[model samples]
Target: MDEGANIPQYKLFINPFDLKELKRDIWIDDPIPAQLKVDGKRLEIDISYRGSHIRDFSKKSYQISFYKPNMFKGSKQIHLNAEYKDPSIIRNKLSFDFFSELGVLSPQSQHVLLTLNGKFEGVYLEIESVDQHFLKRRNLPTGSIFYAVDGDANFSLMSDLDKEIKKSLELGYERKFGPATEDFFLQEFIIKINTIPVPEFEKEIPKYVDVDKYLRWIAGIIFTANYDGFVHNYALYRNRETKLFEVIPWDYDATWGRDVNGKVMEANYVPIEGFNTLTARLLNVESFRRKYRNLLEDIMKKQFTLEFMIPRAEKLLQLIRPYVLQDPYKKQNIDQFDQELEVISNYIKERRNYLQRKLAKLN
Candidate 1:
């Protein structure tokens, strides 16, 4: 890729000693001191390897936290996704764009070139961190954010890992924002969703969660075919004004016709109803189910079509093609990368048809 390409160029300068220590223990969550130069500005940052399984990959993803009062685009932290498994490399960005278009809150992302000590690392997706800064930048109401770290993040009273009763209601979630005392809000919300009587649940659920936003998020996941989204790969935000929790999507590279492993996932892999205790309980209610059905039907007609999505996919692919060609990690997969547009286009067509057939039977 041309050094002067339109894409952002981020150069990291880490001390050899710190770099060695970081590589020595990839599993550790500790961040080492580093310097980042982007857009001609250099700033001190604390960098750490990010992700669970991907940590083992040759090309690793990174999480960078800016020092106090120093930020990038109003975000104190950011994620640099290696996007190794994704041939297209745009799936994560595409999925996030789709969610935002569908009226769901999602992180903003862009493609960029990354370098370490002046050596080309590869093309990366710079994702905006969904934290207090995220909320502030959007001018949205202040809220507490919690990251669903694993399958256990499923809103079930029973653990998905052990299939037994949970010792703590907040087992799977890691709080990213909010005061310590505010933790009860999520715990109480979980308790209510699980323990409320069916008839009463229909009335009470809306008080704790923004049902409309939640359903839109579910719709985004269903259409994108993010199989893990229901159980995890999401964030919960408790809105201060409404006192309702809203779901936000996270880690969606395993979407849009691909699984987390980058395998070809069938268009119909994820059911229209979706999974998870909160979703099941919501859909059980007559009103919420109808609302979800209507929302899906509307999205099918407007947003999830080939015409609407293909252009967006093409644009992203075009923007990153040059960078991908020069990427040391992904250059070998050029053939596969070139074919992602067709792969994505086909998924949209098949997914829309599947959803259409399923929507009619929703009731």
Candidate 2:
């Protein structure tokens, strides 16, 4: 087992459970028995496989949706992110912290020492699930919530038509609220953005999407260099009052100088133009492009500096260091942990310079 942190440790016990079934790449509809001990309280929970990729591997992640609401810190559900592919094991939590600190509506994350059925499961990042509870707490209006599961959620014209016609769940979006299982509201929303003329699109877009939040979200992704986030790996919701779609970020393990597969990425890998057709079209408007460029410059100047980031990274590294070294399921060598942090610190410096150069050419 890993050394315990001063923070609350999550002790989960699964009983009458099939270990083989838990390791399979499928979500069993049935709830498996589990006991959760946290913050001096013990609660029973039903756990299940919650991710598309990590489930297929030996090291697993899970969704802990409590049998009762508010069972855990008023959150109905939380994600135990194994972070198997992240050598540093800090990118997801750090990127999220960066966003939240910048006042963006992003998920909150904390590091937890996890033990499953008496065995250490590594240092997992416990992330707040973007559900009804999350929206209520932030005072954000909620209508329908959809998660982008794969590349098909790229906000392209063709993908929009296919979703409307086929209503394929495999099109990479699953509604978490407000809409029925086969709702076309999300599909139609995408079609509206993809088909409308640029001028009309710009005019009507605010009716369906929060342009400021969307720009800031994209700016954060560009600064963080999260390749997976552009087309997928986010949650989109519509506000009933505004009837506008907004987004919250999710699944950030593959960020901050690494690809989704954990390979080292070039410091200048991401361009200032950002990713996805949505950003490209928005940037086509000169005013919008200027605003986006200003956002990048402001983030680099004000928030994402080494003085601000390094200490936070150091503190988290210290907090989870013991657990990471002791966890039996960790994929990276103990030495790589420090190495990865240094790489990220350096990437931050290089990325700032790269963005400065790109912003200079924006005119």
Candidate 3:
């Protein structure tokens, strides 16, 4: 919400064509090695598999694979974020550590300070790319779907795994994607979510410890109204010999109200193709309240408990602390994160009451 440029947030500006602007919308024309180009310098990548959610600027192709961040990592692909301003980079860098705290499986990450044109830019948490083999086991298609949505509200209308698997379903899911706001950041939203079906022909899915754990972590993510968790945001890993499965969380840029807002905005565009009105997708407060109560109990037992989340949160804060700047531009970014962290950490009891009150009235 704050809009002034500061030192840590903006060191140098990048051309859209520049390598650092690798946020997800661009396309690749060829099948060059899946390396990332940072500040015009190309780093060889471990995996050339193109991302299914975003285009390969070189290959113009989509694969459920990994592309390395085009920066310097020396031997490791994972890095924690340190400091700076770009909003796009800011969110994911924070997420890299946050999910780890929640015990969500994901690539190892490290912090990287990015500078464009010599100015102190924002921070980035460079992560190691996950393997593509996991997707194959899920019976997920190899190439990308023609049109996939990352955590789309429309997909919620379809039967989720809880129902198909016969697990007790939580009614707390939100519907903020309904007909409301016009000019939604649809393109950017794509990076974090995508929908694909489990292949019907593939029978008898393999058992993997991480899959179950990942699902619960994802539920915890949504329980807190964290919506950056789309199907694509998660990936599975399989041991070639054991055939075990693991799920890894990716792309936290859209979590924590990134995809939602209060009910007052006007809309010029309906979210989906056929819906005539926008009222259908508004967040249903009743469902959230019900679902949240159940999820909270579980968080205490599992994900966000003192044994699980606190250490990670403390570690994350420590990891992200140095990169957090007191500088002019970066301060706003840090402040935004700090404000959210406070809301979730210290003010939750009060905030929960307020949120419940608002939800009760809104519904």
Candidate 4:
């Protein structure tokens, strides 16, 4: 990886004997072993085709977990996000950079050229995996990491249909770290998040959660227009220091003027409040509401402006344009890719106007 120009090209070599079967069912229980050669160095890795909607796409995304560290920036796992739905191929990168710039913990991402068996596999957004390594690198306190597996993982208590489902692991939390014994306690945390009385929650929530950071995270999601992230596309980490859960954004290819299913998102699609139960509850608290409004106003003034982002977007487009054109398996043509960049620029402008109008209406 170049310090000045961080994007790196990776070449993957896989044995032909297992290619047919592996490609046929890439999302199997076991990871397929392959040799990844990058920058004149070879390393062993367990690569698997990952994602639900994207798994069926012509250009497949991959989850690459190295058997040994130092293969790629001293990390154990990373995602080669196939920006299949995103014609611009920079939405995730743009949104992730926004979060990181705002002092929030977000996955580090870069554009990378990928080739499998010497065949181009399109330009992929290489994203940092938010696992144990992520926590350690950021010096965040180690605790249970829960990924929102399905729509049921929405923070609303109504999402969980069964009251008897005591196992936190089964409650759609999908514990990625910490002890298994913490499952019962983790379930209790979910219950508190969902069912706690508003008055009590307002008073006691801070003991278990950082309301300020949470509001900022929600603001980031709103700014990026990541509707999927509000409910299901996030990671909730139990902060051992504060003993409160912190929200981390995930699966951002759906963001920045587009939904996960590739539909255009309206500039004002997400309301300032009422996006979800957690947000609604937080906004009900006067202090949190004030802080959230301030955050949004500040972000629009300092961060969300097109002046700050357009050049970066153009640079990213410049970096990935050739790869997109050369990728035979890409879903969209080169013209569509260029058009998507225009659409993204227009979205930033329209969204800024919508937000300014919406901010004025807030009390």
Tens-place lDDT per residue, model 3, 1-363, is: 222232122222334453333444354423233443344555444322244433322222122122444334333323223222223234454455556655655455445454534544444444554433223434443321111224232223333434432121111222121222211322212211222223311122223222345344444344334343443355433333443434456555443333322121112111111120111221122343344345445554565333443344455555544555533345555656555443334323432344444433333
Over 4 Å off, model 3: 1-103, 132-211, 228-230, 242-246, 256-298, 301-329, 332-338, 346-363
Q: Candidate 1: minimum summed lDDT over ten consecutive residues — where?
A: 66-75
- Model 2 C-alpha lDDT per residue in residues 201-303, reported as the tens digit of each score: 6677677678888988888888888877878879888887787788788988878888888898887777778767777788888787888878777888888
Better of 2 and 3 by TM-score: 2
- Tell me, by lDDT, which candidate is best: 1
Cα-based TM-score, every candidate:
0.98, 0.91, 0.44, 0.92
lDDT assessment of candidate 4: 0.78
Higher-lDDT candidate among 3 and 4?
4
Output the TM-score of candidate 2: 0.91
Model 3, global lDDT: 0.36
Worst 10 residues of 4 by lDDT: 160-169
Tens digit of per-residue lDDT, candidate 4, span 172-250:
6688888887576666665677777877878877776678878878888888888766777888888877788888888
**What C-alpha lDDT, on a 0 to 100 scale, does residue 267 get in candidate 4?**
81
Candidate 4 colliding pairs? 208-244
Model 3 clash count equals 34
Per-residue lDDT over 1-363 for candidate 1, one digit per residue giving the tens place of the 0 to 100 score: 478467889999999999999999999999999999988888899999999999999999999999743787788999999998898999999999999999999999988899999889989999999999999999999979999998888889999999999999889999999998778998999998899999799888889998999999999999999999998999999999989999999999998898889999998899989989999999998899999999998998889889899999999999888878888998899999999999999898888888888886679
